[model samples]
Target: MKITIWPAGILAIIFFISTSCKQNAPHEDAAEPAFVAHPVAVPKQDVMTLEIGKAAPDFRLPDVNGKFVSLSDFDEAKVLVIIFHCNHCPTAQAYEDRMIDFTNEYKEKGVDLVAIMPNSAMGLLPEECGYTDLNDSFEEMKIRYEYKKYNFPYLYDGDNQSIAIAYGPVATPHAFVFDKERKLQYSGRIDGVEKPGGANAEDLRAAVDALLAGKPVETPVNKVFGCTTKWAWKSEYGKKVEEKWNAQPSTISRLDEDGIMALVKNPTEKLRLINIWATWCAPCVMEYPELVALQRWYGHRNFEFVSLSADNPEHQDRALAFLEKTHSPVQNFIYAGTDKYKLIEAVDPKWDGALPYTLLVEPGGKVVYSSQGPVDLLELKRAIVEHPLMGRYY
Candidate 1:
């Protein structure tokens, strides 16, 4: 008897409700960025700290311009700092303001700041970490580098990672401070602070201030923590990449008369143990078994060993064959030239040029022992018995 709501009215009401619900719903948040994960497990290593009073190691590396720069170059400064840093580390990023302020405060005080980036793994090639890359394309690094207006150079560790390994630096922003006489004075965390927004102790700043005031730096070392250096060149290509970047003008890949003479002339005082032989020479061949053993015995010592092969163009093929045959543990290089005798004489002029000549050149280029024939291990061992650089195990 009462008029019921019509189906059309009900439909209209449902449609209105659906439309209202669609309009009021919240949107989903955008996806977050992803980072590349390490391929293998990295063992958590205890943070390493250098000791005070240890002689700060010296090293040379390329700046942004691909020029050689060394720690010794900053000798005139009253205090010197070598800081290992990277662009991506948040801990390192936190120090931007402090680094800038420190630079400004100490620049006029004759202190030098040298920041090293050991992130060679970030680049496709070993040489790409040059100054231009750090200055131009690395937005984060460039921004930090510019903001700091660092008085000192931000150096790149090219193919030869000699500096990073030498310092045993485990983190970004790892620091070592040296006094005027080049003795290590302080090393450790920038200031007892680890993460951002920590309480302000400023240990590093305090140490530097003390040194600048002509007072002894009481804090000699610190345990630095941050991202580890990711150096990529691992396999054969990696080796080539590193060698290409660190290639010196004086470096000779093939040992020739000219190269041997140059090394002999350059380091007059160091012990020079030159091993001359060839794959085809039989006695030069027969003695190789013993020579291979002797080479292994003394491989790790301080004396320089030049394993010269007179095989010329045939060197690579024959050397590989010899390596395959004996599974020889000795590392050897082939002498490439048409005239082997002239090359030998150029290295040492005293007598007839001969293969298997083993000579120990003193610091002054004096020949300690010159053996014209194949080397006897016992005889050679006796010659190097008490010698300073030849006593260590490989």
Candidate 2:
């Protein structure tokens, strides 16, 4: 009779039948029932990255706990789950809770989990890190681990991604299951779903159980789908995006004290980020490139970004040239007033006239954030994305 093979039901039946036949039959070949389910095809990246049915390559990566973890160290386990995970990818973040559950479910049953960060932080840019709080860096991983209280060992391999290369993880949430001999058994996603708690960890769980029960995994090489492993060469991709936005025409306009106060008061229908910088200020020049990236990423939404030049009134041409060269995509202005103190106070009375200052102003001129120095780009985005008024737009 043809049967649909569910992991739990098929395993239970196979266990009963195999045990009964062993108890009654002689020590000769007694034909046992075999449950066959077609395995998923491997992805192109996996074919290039890892060898199937081979001994797992050994690794000694440092975990978030400050201890070194090697693959061979877990030889005591009947089956080990090696996951290529990272802190940034939303797909990886979504699977965190389920990954914890999967490990806890089988920890005492001679099964264990080791998660590897497969992307290099050097390859990561701030724009590629918009979804999560933590970057894929080891230090950020520690912060995430402590904050999340993960049950399994999270190893950092991103400095080189050598282990990631050896195992061939195509995506952040990809996994590989190995039997006691440390031979690769299954490699792919933990489940088919990409969202948090979307699918049961059936693929991974089934493979682990099968190996523990002395049965081969039914689906050995399912394809993984998530953020690609960020190789070092991909670092330039973010720069290209920045360059594209910078290539667009940059324009500047004159704003008198009344007009400048209007932008500060945010008469327009959007959240405005006002930056006070001068062409000659070193700190302002240093922060301009990142601010340009931010303008490109969020300027299309219900948000606005502009730079106000603190340059002298006669130096308006110099300020305009700087704005164009820096690729400030939004509207730009030159302070048209004589009193610098009045202008700084008009923006915010709590002001010390400082170069490279910033303010995130809500509609109707409510000042949400005011900074006297170069803004921390990552932290600034996080604050805006998490704010009650601005979160929904993102």
- Please provide, for model 1 over 1-394, each residue's C-alpha lDDT reduced to its tens digit, 9 standing for 90 to 100: 8997679989999999999998887656644333222222223334334567777778776664446688789988988877887654546666656666777777888888788876544333322221111211223344546544655677766344556666667777788888888777887678766654573427777777889898986766667766556544333455675565335221114666767776566464446666677776766777766554433334434445556666775557766577446545344666667786687676687757656566766665667777887776545655663465543111
* Candidate 1 displacement at residue 171 in angstroms: 0.7
What lDDT does model 1 reach?
0.61
Ten-residue region with minimum lDDT total, candidate 1: 128-137
Top-lDDT structure, candidate number: 2
* Total clashing pairs for each candidate: 9, 0
**Model 2 misplaced regions, further than 4 Å:** 1-52, 64-68, 104-108, 121-127, 133-151, 197-202, 209-216, 233-246, 257-272, 279-290, 296-304, 321-330, 340-356, 361-368, 372-378, 387-394
- State the lDDT of candidate 2 residue by residue for 120-239, as single tens digits: 655676556646656788778888787778999998876656677688788888988888888888988788877664687889988988998899889999988888887755656767
Q: After the best TM-score superposition of candidate 1, give how far the Cα of residue 159 lies from its true spot, in angstroms.
A: 1.9
TM-score of each: 0.41, 0.69
lDDT values, one for every candidate: 0.61, 0.78
